[model samples]
Target: MSYTPLVDAEGFAAFPAPAKLNLFLHIVGRRADGYHLLESIFQLVDAHDTVWLRVRDDGQIVHHNPMPNVPAETDLTVRAAKLLQTATGVSYGVDIRVDKRLPMGGGMGGGSSDAATVLLALNRLWHVNWQRQALMDLGLQLGADVPFFIFGRNALVEGIGEIMTPIETEATDFVVLHPPVHVPTPAIFGDPELTRNTPSLKVSLLEGTADWRVLRNDLESVAVRKYPQIAQHIQWLSQYAPARMTGSGSCVFAAFVAKDVEKNTSQNQANAVIFGLPKEMSGFVTSSLQEHQLLGFASD
Candidate 1:
């Protein structure tokens, strides 16, 4: 789909902000500063939300739709634009039109990815050319998940998603089932019985492990306890591949070991089912992305 470009002195710039999955999240402990320490493998997916933007003369940030449930002022897209405007000292403003295809609060990093796209797109559109570290710093202020999107790869994230280390894996495809329901992330994290002390594993060990069955999301049980639909989806997807909850999920995904084999050989595979939300809810199956793609409004 094409977007109508907002007028700007320097024209427009666009970026494709992709969603991500936490292959496994282990919350180790809470620090004295109250930040939760975590370890997870973050893999970006090809499915994405497109954000279109152009510089505005008055330095005002505007978002289309403004997300009914989330406050306009508190939305990450607005905060991200404001942060970039302040950091770059660019007198220019931005008009951002977000095509939000990714399900909100699905543990898919939709909002955070959008925020990261804004930062990255604005840096180029505004001619800021700030270093990657600077962009990451700007992204972190927006949200914990934002920085990892900036890195734009499969990553081993730690320390509330600030710390990033690259990881490589065999090509894999995922079928993610999203329930129409919204699962509040904070509520799951705040659960008293939530596991917060999974022993950390080395990056080398993770690389050597072929069977992902050994890795797990420590928060999955707590999430299942909070939302039974999550548990149900997990059960359904597990029949196809080793499926588990992603982040604090209302969305769960399974990785196929052999895409070709599964597509042709798995005759008994059941039809995919999405629970909680209506059968009409939109969902997707996409492969992992090597790098994030940038999109925007273009004069045609």
Candidate 2:
């Protein structure tokens, strides 16, 4: 079923911040600024962390429930609201409460997505009325993946996550396994043995001629070397389908393509896989999202 935002009787609007899976990540090059140039198809999924927002007239952004160890000032949702208020000089603030569901450091883009949702939801809540691209530009300042969530569609992302081109992806279900480990992104990217010379396939991807199944994440090898549990999860899931690590590390997924005659075929396959998972492993079944739930919150 499609997702939607909801408002409670107390006037708190709950906005869904959906997670994302990197179908295939390639490190094509690195810039002089030490930022790695990447090419990946970012697929939106149904797994979400809800951000409940209520406008405040006092012009003070407050986070009612911050994630453990993450201060409210550092929390992406709070930061996003503050950023918007500062950028637009809107004499308004918000109370933020995030129902954190996605795993931390699992490469699921949870924090980034929450930040994006705040930016989208508050644009209207505060009547900022900034165009979507402007908000996307603002989102880039928050996190690389934040802009893509604001972009709000399955996209061929490139250029350190700023460039995005919408791409058509078939509906599919994925069983995402989050290994119990927090991968430090810098360590993985700093590994000397990490591959950084994958050829760019931007042309093929845009032309719709690329065979994505054969493509792979270049960072997987580095991440697996540092965290063997990730490799173990990938190995276990691969037995069911062609499994791979998404984004940096920790979370791995195997896709189940949908069938025409059986509408529930993919979900069933995912459910069975999750049901049979080893007790030590943890994961959930989620389908591809055609667009972000707040895609219409901002105008193009």
Candidate 3:
């Protein structure tokens, strides 16, 4: 149910790079190497960046429209393409065009998802046919979060970000608010005041026993203290639901579930937040996706 292996009408292979929310991020400990051990629920959402790729035989990686202020070489999508080519020794290349709708540095996992998309798409486009685990291993070289996106499901992630256990989730909605400033992950992780010893959680986020309202993001304290804009956005959203920061975030969101989706109440709730937001803040209402669009692309 995850992948449809066909090029679209535009004659380009279109792939979706979806966004994710850390329902709650807990820092359990730190590894000997300095990477923080984490326990988090990663929920995939409908909000996404779209990657359109056309394979080339000449062994060149290209981004048709790179993001502003980001060098084409440094773009994760481009890097992903080149890395896959080099690692697999493939003769094929790609012309990638990105339609970016997610916020950069908002802790929504935009860049990581884009990189996953390229790896997944090209595995299909170039006929490299790597297994999902192999692709996930390659993805880790790009970023810690990259493997989760490649895993392509709602997941419970732990360890230094590579350990993943896919969990079930129903279709859900959220009002995601992106504040104007960037909250650097290093700044949040490096803060001395950040809690590094939150006890581990064992409940299943999929089983309805884990009350998200009681769960908390340990990084939130550090990020909110450093960025007032993020704090303000969280405060505004708190009026409607239990607002929480996602990842080391400048964006905050509140989840909404439906008794009957036919009623369309969740979407309205998301819209209410959007309509009431001040012009300085940006946001959208989005629903969760059960699987990544390229979920079956890899040989699982």
Clashing pairs in 3: none
* CA deviation > 4 Å runs, candidate 1: 1-13, 69-71, 258-282, 294-300
For model 3, the stretches where C-alpha displacement exceeds 4 angstroms are 2-10, 203-208
* Per-residue accuracy of model 2 over 181-278 as CA lDDT, tens digit each: 99999998999998899999999998989978789999999999889999999999999999999999789999998875266888898999999999
Can you rank all candidates by lDDT, best first? 2, 3, 1
Each prediction's RMSD over C-alphas, in Å, is 5.2, 1.5, 1.7
Candidate 1 residue 155 Cα shift, in angstroms, is 0.6
TM-score computed on alpha carbons, candidate 1: 0.84
Quick one: best lDDT, which candidate? 2
**144: Cα error in model 2, Å:** 1.0
Query: By TM-score, is 1 or 2 better?
Result: 2
Residue 33 Cα positional deviation in candidate 3, in Å, after optimal superposition: 1.6
All candidates: TM-score: 0.84, 0.97, 0.95
Model 1: per-residue Cα lDDT at residue 300: 10
Candidate 3 to truth, TM: 0.95
Number of the top-ranking candidate, with TM-score as the measure? 2
- lDDT per residue for candidate 3 within 218-246, as digits (tens), equals 99988888988889999989999899899
The residue-by-residue lDDT of candidate 1 on 122-158, one tens digit each, is 8777878777777887788888888878776687788
Error of 1 at 86 (Å): 0.8
